[model samples]
Target: MLKKSDYRVVRALGHGSFGSVFQITEIASGKQLVWKRMTIVNDEDRKMALSEAEILQNNKSDYLVEYYGQFEDESEFYILMEYCEKGDLRKYINHLRELKAITSEDMLLDIFAQLTEAIFSLHSANIIHRDLKPENVFMTDNFIIKLGDLGMARVIMGTQQHLSRIGGTIQYFPPELLIQIEESEIAKTDLRPQEPVIQTKQCDMFSLGVIIYELITLKHPFADQNGEVLRTNIIKCKPNPLPNNTPESLKQLIMQLLCKDPTQRPSIQKNKKEKHQKKNKIKNQKKKNKKEKNQKKNKKEKHQKNKKEKHQKKNKKEKNKKNKKEKQQKKNKVKNQQKKNNNEKHQKKNKKEKHQKLNKEEKNQKKNKKEKHQKKNQKEKQQKKKNNKGKHQKKNKKEKQQKNKKEKHQKKKKKEKNQKNKNGKQQKKNKVKNQKKNNNKEKHQKKEEEEEKKEDEKKEEEEKKEKKKDHKDKKEDKDKKEDKDKKDKHHKEKGKDESSEEDKKGQVQHDKNKEKKEHHKEKDGKGEEKKEEKDKDEHHKDKKKEEKKKDKKHEDDKDKGKKDHHKKEEDKKDHHKKDEDKKDHHKKEEGEKKVETEKKEDKKEDKKEDKKEHHKKDEEKKEEEKKKDHSKKEEEKKDEKKKDHKDKKEDKKEEEKKDHSKKDEKKDHKDKKDKDEKKEEGEKKDDKKDHHKKDEKKEKEDKKGKKKEKGDDSDKGEEKSPNVVQAQDIKGDA
Candidate 1:
C-alpha cells in the first residue's frame, strides 16, 4: 500500500552502520517527516529492520516519534517517522559543553521527565527501548524531546526475560547486561545450560542515567575506554559522583538508576508518578506562599493603621489640652478685669493704695495657682504618653515574637512534611517491587497448577474410559457364556439320565444366581465411583467459586482504600478552606470592632475618662459575646460532622452486612438446588436399581419354571427304558 514515490527526500539527516536517516516531505500534504533507510542484505536483515516499524505502528505515544508508514525497495527498507528539526540531545549537550555552560537543573529535569514518559510508554506496551542514548533523543523547537531510533528495541511477552543481545551503545550498557554478556561467553566454556537473563528496561534505565549524568556534568559516569578495560570497568566499577552543583534528589535518583542489580533500579512509572506529585506539591506550596504573603501584607497594613490611629489620638489629646488651657486663660483675664473694676469703685470711695495692694496680692496668688495647675497637667500628660508608648512597644515585641515562632513552626512543619514524603515514597517503592515479584511468582505457580490439574483430569478420564471398555467386554463374554450354557442344558434335559440332568440344572441355577449377585455388586461399585467423581467435581467448582470471591474482595478492598484516601484528602482541603474562611471572617469582624470603638471614643470625647473606660468595658463584653457565639457555632459544626461521619460508617457497615447476607443467601440457594438435583438423581438411580432387581427376579423365576418342566419331562423319560435314554443322551452329547 505504501510507495516511495509519495515522498521526496529533502536531505540526509544522519548515517549509521546499518541505516541512514533522511528528511523527507510528503507530496500530497507537503508534511515533513524522517525516512529511515536500512540497507538490507538478507532476510534476517530485513526482518530486523522491519521490527522498529512494527513496534511503532502497534504502539503510539506523544513522547515517542510518530510512525507514518513503511515501504521497502529491492535493497533498502524505508520507514517514515515524525521529523524533529532541532536535532538530537547529544548535539544540544555538545553545544552546551562547547559554550562551557552547564545545563540548568530545570531543563535537565524536564528532559529526564520527557524521556521517562517515552520510556514508560514503550514499557507499558511491553517494548523495551534497548538503544536509549542522547543520540536517540531528538528535540523540538520548543525543547520538547521525542524519543526515536527504536531500531534495537525488543517487545517481550509476559514475565519472560530476554536474552542478552549485541545491540545498543557499549558505553551505556548496564552492569547486569554486561555481566550477562560475559557469563554467556563463560557458559560456553563451562558447559552451562542457561545464562542469567536481565530485564531490558533496566538496560534502558542505565542508559538514561548516563545521559542525565552527561547532561549535568558533560562527562561519562563510567569508564569509556576501548575493549576489555571498558567491559571490566562497566562490570565492576562504580559510576563517578555527579557534580556538587547537582540537586541532592537528582543525584540520588541517578545513583539508584545506575545500581548494579537490575531489580534495584526504580521503575519509570514510579518516577513519572513522583514527578507529578512533586509538581502538585510545588503548585500547592506556591499557593500557600501567596496566601501567607497576602495575610502578612494585611497584618502590616493593620499595624500601620493602628499606629496612625495612636498618633491621631496623641495629637487629639494634645490639642484638647491646648484648648482647655486657652479657655482657662480667657476666664482668668475676664475675672481679672472684673476684679479691677471692683477695686476702682472701692478706691474712689476709700483708700486707693489699700485697694491696689489687695488687687496685687490676689493677682500673685492666682498666678501661683495657675502655674501649679499647668505643671500638674503637663506631668499627667507626660506619664500617659509614656504609658501608651510602653504599651505600643510591648505589643510590637509580642507580635514580632509570635511572628518568629510561627515562622519556626512553619519551617518545622515543612521539614516534617518533606521527611514524611520521602519515607512514604521509599515505602511505596518497596511495596511495588514486592507486589510485582509476588504477582509474577503467583502467576507462574497458578499456571503450573492449572497445567497439572488438566493433565491429571485427562489421565483419570482416559483410565475411566479403558476400565469402561474392559467392563463392557467382560459383560459381553458373560452374556455369550450364559447363552451357550442354556443351549447345552436344553440338549442335556432332552436326552441325558434324569439324575445327571437334574444335578446339571441345579449347578447352572446356582452359577446364574452368583453371576447376578456379582453383576449387582459391580453396578453398586460403579454408582459409588460416579458419585465420588460428582462430589470431586462439585468440590472443584466450589473451590473455584471461593477463589473468585476472594479475588473480588481483594479488588473491592483496593477500591475502598483508594476511595478512603481521596475522601481524606478532600476532608483536609475542606478544613483548610474553612480555616481560611474563619480567618477572613475574624479579620473583617476585628476591622468592624475597631471602627465601632473609634466611633464610641469620638462620641465620648467630651465625657469624663470614667465614661470612656465604661464604653471600652462594654465593647470588650460585646467582643467576648461574639467570640462565644462563634465558638458555639464551631462546636455545633464539629458535632454535626461527627454525627455525619458516624452515620456514614454505620451505613457502610450495614451495606457490608447486607452484601454478606445476600451472598450467603445465594450460596444457600445454590446449595439447596444442588442438593435437590442430587436427591432427584439418587431417587432415579434407586428406582432403576429396583427395576433391574425385579427384572432379574422375573428372569430367575422363568428359568426355574423351565427347569421344572424339563425335570417333569425327565421323570417321564425315566419311566421308559434307561438304555434307550442313555443311547439318546450319548447321541445328543456327540
Candidate 2:
C-alpha cells in the first residue's frame, strides 16, 4: 500500500541499533530527503526529536541543514531532513584517503566559518550542540557545510536542564561532560542529586576543538593504543601535541576551544573585539607616528640648512688636515717596510755564514779518525811476521828426526789407525744421530711456532672483523639519528615558513593601509596648497583696490588731512580685521579639510582593508595549495626514506648472510687443518714405534747364539716390565 505513495524509499543511508536513515525520493519534486527512522518509539525519543524539529523549524540559517517534517508509519517514526549529496565530513575524510591528499585549508576555513556561524546562531537561540563532530556535520556538492544531528542538543534557560542520559561518542566527549557526569555521580552518592547541572555553550566549543584538531592533523588528538586506551588517556592524560606543521592561528584557536575549564574558554564576542581593536590601534599609531616624524624632520632640515653655511669653512680646513695626515701615514708605512726588509737580509747572511763554518769542522774530524785507524793496523802486521820466521827452522829439524823413527812404528801405527777409524765411525754415527734428533725437535718447534702464529693471525682477523662490524653498526645508528633529526628540523622549518607567510600577509596588509593613508594625506596637502594660493591671490586683489582708493584721497589731502588720516587708520584696521578673518577662515577650512580627509582616509582604509582581506583570502588559498604541495613532497620524502631504510635493511641482511657463510668456510678450513695435523702426529708415532722395534731386533742379533737366550730373557724381562720404560730407554739410546 505504501509503494503507491509520492515518496519512495530508495535504500537505507545509515543504520544504528535503534535508528536508521533512509534516502527517499519525492515523486513530484524528484528531490531526495534523508528519513531517520527510529524503531524504539518511546516517549523520550519522540520528545527529543520533536524538540529538535521545533528548533530547526524556527531557526533558519544557511549554515544549518533544513528540517522538513516528522511523520509516522505503521512500524517506525521518520524524521525527514535535507539531503546532502556529499554526505557527512567523516565520509569525506574517508574518501580523501583514497586520494591520499589532505583537505585544503580553504575547505577547512569554509567549514569552520559555517560551523562557527551555525554555533553562534544556535547559541543565540539558547541551543547547544552537545555532540559536535565531523560525523554530525554534512557538506553539499557545492561546498556548503551544514551542521546537523540535534539529537543531543539542549535548550538553556533560567533553570538548568539536562538530558538524563548522555549521548555522544566516547572519542569526541569533551572534558566538561566527563566532569559533569562525575559530579552528578558524586551528588548521587551524597543524596543531593537534585538534577544534573546542564551543559553550556563552552561544552560545544570543546568538541569543536577536537574536530579542529582532527581536521588539521588528520588524526585524533587523544588517540592511544586502542579504544580503551584512548578513552583512558582522554579522561586522564592530556592530549599529545599537535603536529608541528599545524598553522599557528589554527593551533591557537583550537587551544582556546579545548580549555578544560569552561570559564577559561574564549568568548566569541571577546575574541572578535580583541582581534579588531588590536588591528585598529596598530594601524592608527603607525599613521600618527609617521606624520609626527615627518613634521619633526622638516623642522630639523630647515635648522640644519641655516647652520650649513657657517660650518663650510671649518669643513674645508678639516678636509685639508685629513689629506695631509693620510699622506704622512702612507710615507711612514713605506719606511717601516724598508727597515723590515733590511733586517731580514742581514739575518739571512748571518745564518749562511754559521752553516758554512759547521760543515768545515765536520770534514776535519772525519780526516783525523781515518789517520788513527791506519797507524794501529800497520804495527800489528809487523809483529806477526817476526814470530812466524823463528818457528820455521825448528819445525824442519823435528821433521828429519821423526822420519828415521817412522819405519819401526809403522805396524803399531796401522793397528792404532784401524781402531781409531772404528771409533771415528762410531762418533760420526753418534753425530748423525744427534743431528737427526735435533732436526726432528726443530721441526716440532717450527710446527708449534707456525700454529701459534696462525692462531695470532686468526685472533687479529677476528678483532678486525668485530671492529668493522661495530663501526658499521655505529654508522647505521648515527645515520638513523641524523635522519630523524633532519625530519624534525624540516617539520619545524615548515611551521616557521607558514607563520612567516602569515606574518608577511599581515605586513602586506599593513603596508597597503599605510599607502592608502599616505595617498589621502598627499591629496589633502595638494588641496591645502591650492587654498593657500587662492588666499594669496585674494590678498593681492585687496591690496590693489586699497592702493586705488589711496590715490583718489591724495588730491584732497590738505583739506581733509585729519579725516583722511583717521579714514586711513580705519581702513588699515578694517584691512587688518579682514586679514584676521581670512586667517581664521583658512584655519577653519584647514581643520575641516583635515577632518574630512581623515574620514575619507578612514573609509579608504576600510575599503583597502576589505580588499586586503580579499587578497589575504586569495593568499590563504594559495597557501593552502602550497601546504598541500608541501605535504605531498613531505610524504614523498617519507616514502623515499622508508624505501631507503628498507634497502639498507636488506643490504644488512645480505651482509650478515655473507658473514655467516664466511664464518662457516673458516670453521671448515680450520677443522681440515686440525685433522691433517693429527694425522701427521699419528704417522710420526707409528714411525717411532717401528724404529724402536728395529733397534730391539739389532740388539738381539748382536748378542750371538750363546747369549741369545740371555738377550731373549732380558727382552722378555723388559717387555714384562712395561712398554713405556723400554721405549724411553730405546729412544734415549737412539
Q: Who wins the TM-score comparison?
A: 1
Q: Write model 1 residue lDDT over 438-460, tens digit each, in one string.
A: 79766755664575466457546
Look at candidate 1 and tell me the lDDT of residue 528. Answer: 38
Residue ranges of candidate 1 with Cα displaced over 4 Å: 180-199, 224-229, 271-734
Model 2 Cα lDDT, one tens digit per residue, 118-173:
78878877787777878889987666778987777778776433544565555666
Off by over 4 Å in 2: 1-4, 159-163, 179-197, 225-229, 270-734
Write down the RMSD of all candidates, one decimal each: 67.4, 58.6
lDDT of 2: 0.65
Model 1, C-alpha of 707: deviation from truth (Å): 99
Instruction: List lDDT for all candidates, in order.
Output: 0.70, 0.65
